[model samples]
Target: MYLTQGLHRSLQRHPDKPALRHVGDGDVRTHTFAELLRDTGQHAAALQARGVKAGDRVALLAPNHDRLVRALLACWWLGAVACPLNVRWSAPELAYAVSDSEASLLVVDEALAGLVRELPLPVIDFEQLAQEAQGLQALPDVRAGGDTLAAILYTGGTTGRSKGVMLSHANFWTASMTRGAELNNAPDSVSLLVAPLFHVAGLGRLVGQTLVGGTCVTMAHFKPAAVLEAIERHGISDVVVVPTMLQSLLDDPGFAPERVRSLNRIAFGAAPMPPDLLERALQAWPHAEFFQAYGLTETAGAVCINLPDNHRDPAALAQGRLNSVGRAGLGAEIQIVDESGRELPAGQVGQIIVRGPMVTRGYWRLPEASAEALRGGWLHTGDAGRMDAQGYLYIVDRLKDMIISGGENIYCAEVESVLRTHPLVSQAAVIGRPDPHWGEVVHAVLVLADGATAEQLPLPVLRDWCHERLAGYKCPRGLSHVPALPLSAAGKVLKTVLRQQLAA
Candidate 1:
């Protein structure tokens, strides 16, 4: 199915309904379904005027905004692929994604417009785009469907590079439909889109809401106070958050159980949720249903979901249901398999694999990697997890040394690479350290250069240096000065030994 079909349905079903409420630092702005569609048409015409044809890739660099949403629809309306660059990434990181995607045009919000000024492609902000589309006729829908490429989302790779995960229109539709009320609620549901749309979870939620003819409340930036304000003002019925965001909201001074009483559903995932925080959350919102979803960028969205029923009873956590990522979602087949692709029996920890309509086609222009990932007709998740006899999935560990800090995936190798570039660093080994608030934070073990001493580079100094090269989340939150890293015979860092020594 086409992505814009829901917009059409909403247009016919409830033209005057509030389709979007954008909560920027300025005054809140709401858009009706008809207005949304009208704005999308104008944006589509603007793209067409710039000679953006079907199959062309358009890059968007911005936070959550109604204009960004409309621009996404505009791309789909013309059968073009929309590639949203991660806002947290540095200029070089974003440049890499844009270059890899081969985007035809770049869309930006004013705040980030300057970072991309040097790029060769045409750059236009939303305001200018709207002004340019003033009198242009609306472009007719191309009706792109099935395997037609819809988006190119960039995710960190094992090689310390970013890979563009190519998701089609069908993949998005299947994932959204299968997710259903688990993430999406009733047709009239009002969802707060606080999560950045560049990620699959956030994009999937948006599609899920659209599929059900629901209203979306966009946030230009996520602030605990702003989220509370939006929920109280709009009577938001549904929300999707990571554990970090959840704890921050609860800890925010303005947070009152009464302010968020309108919330009926809260879908959380993307990182491990601390049990203590989850327990506190359950206590805080007794009336709200909480669920956890497990998925990858390759799966478009939810592969497995721990339903709200699993979280209702306190004993469920002791019984193991609450700790699980849940059983395979509708239309998804999840299995734990060995190296030879043989499915392991229950209780056997192995690689988690998923096969379903939601699975993405492959990495953009990386056929060998694509073939390797999708071999045996199942997408290898590179995550170590186990399944119970009753079908609940428990994630044990990550096969890849990837750290999830504050809901952002930080590849250890990538962080190590950046750290190695420092003049004072002779060698570096990066690992994830469990943190109460951020799920897991990046921690490093470093070997000083020949003339450098431990006092030469402090944690604060290194953090500022790394922030210049990498995203703040990926920067090392703490570090230890070591003579040398513990290495295996294969010349790989022995992360377990480092963890053991650190713990001791």
Candidate 2:
């Protein structure tokens, strides 16, 4: 089960098939399977010429595009590890990852040339490098095996600093295969590539589509109008989106069901979605199947996926499985366990642990942290959840997000849920702020509805509103109305920034 096996086979079976389509610099580009193979071969040769050998890490810091995909294939073709850094990260953050990975060669798109120059590694423009590499001879030993390290994706370190999650060929191969099988993917599927390829969710699918000989349409950045336009113009069959992106699409005024009639599947995961909005999406795009898959960088991309059957039946939701993340995927096991590592009974809320072939080998070189996360043969997911008798998983709040104030435990989601019920709130982010007496207190930052101001809407009134829904202790002690919350490119709230600003 080599990771590049499918691509290799595709070149033989359907060499002239449409492999990629990318929009960039005011032009649209398309490449066939044979063209992709030729470019990958040349890129591999160029990397080899530049001292990139087997086992060396070649980092790519770029957004979603044709070159990113080609570079990834080139790395696998040369048996070199591809370390894709998040393009949204600052120069310092990029340097940290490059140094940690000890990447010998750094590939950057022209837009990021300045950032790449600051790093100590040899910097190569992704487009120029691929073009130059195409001229070299293709080597026989470039294909990577199942056990070879394909990527070392760094997680957004919420607890401390980010750590690299080492993924083998098998891990990526399995993730792609499972995703295709779960969605009943076909060769003619036109998957949208709007999310940045640096993320496991985005890049994993990029590889998946190519492996299955499907066409990919790349968007440099996701714009609501552009996404809708692409769907109508290209007849996009499937799109992988996070909760926030999906919401934006559903919120668009031009979102006509007929405009996206060709869209058969919409796979959303990355972050938790507001249930109400998710329901609206289902209503708006009745023809498209909505599948919610749950995963983290540590598990390649997806560990569990809610199947089409579960999404179609609202009755299953009433029976205590309201759009719950479905059972574990193939080659995976999930369990709810207590602090002592003993498995809990069904319907009991506890820490969610996962064990699977796609789980990372370990956190890169941090033996202590690795041991802490991978205890008892299961990757401690740090997420809190419970499984029903029929094995549907319901996600609770994060363990750290649980607030303890005045000897009573309060979940922030419970408070946020009540606040969200108010029609005046546009968005709400709940966090535990430091308190001198209580050790910690609940803080709520909100984006208000039209014609509302933080000065006019005092903390007392908001507190009173929450009091009607939640208990006194759970009510936020402080409220700050903000125009916008700090968000990552993928649409997840940058809680770390919020926590820092509130701490200051």
Best by lDDT: 1
Give the clashing residue pairs of candidate 1, or none: none
- Where does model 2 exceed 4 Å of error? 450-452, 455-457
For every model shown, the clashing-pair count is: 0, 3
**On residues 1-504, what C-alpha lDDT tens digit does candidate 1 reach at each position?**
999998899999999999988986867889999988888888899998998999999999888898889899899999999998888678888888888888999999889987898988989998888888778888888889899999999984334688899999999998887788355458889999888898887788898888778999999777899899989988999888876588769879999999999999999987666666688899999999999889888998887889888898767766879889988888999999987889999998789999999998899999999999999899999988889998999986677666778887676756776787788886677888889999989999998878898888999999999999897888888889988776422123567777778777
The superposed Cα distance between candidate 1 and the true structure at residue 205, in angstroms, equals 1.0
lDDT of 2 by residue, 140-227 (tens): 6456778789889887755667799999988888887767666667888999998777788887888788778889999889888788
Which residue window of length 10 is worst by lDDT in model 2? 314-323
TM-score attained by model 1: 0.81
The residue pairs found clashing in candidate 2 are 42-133, 42-134, 77-142
Runs of candidate 1 with Cα error greater than 4 angstroms are: 157-159, 181-184, 314-318, 402-504
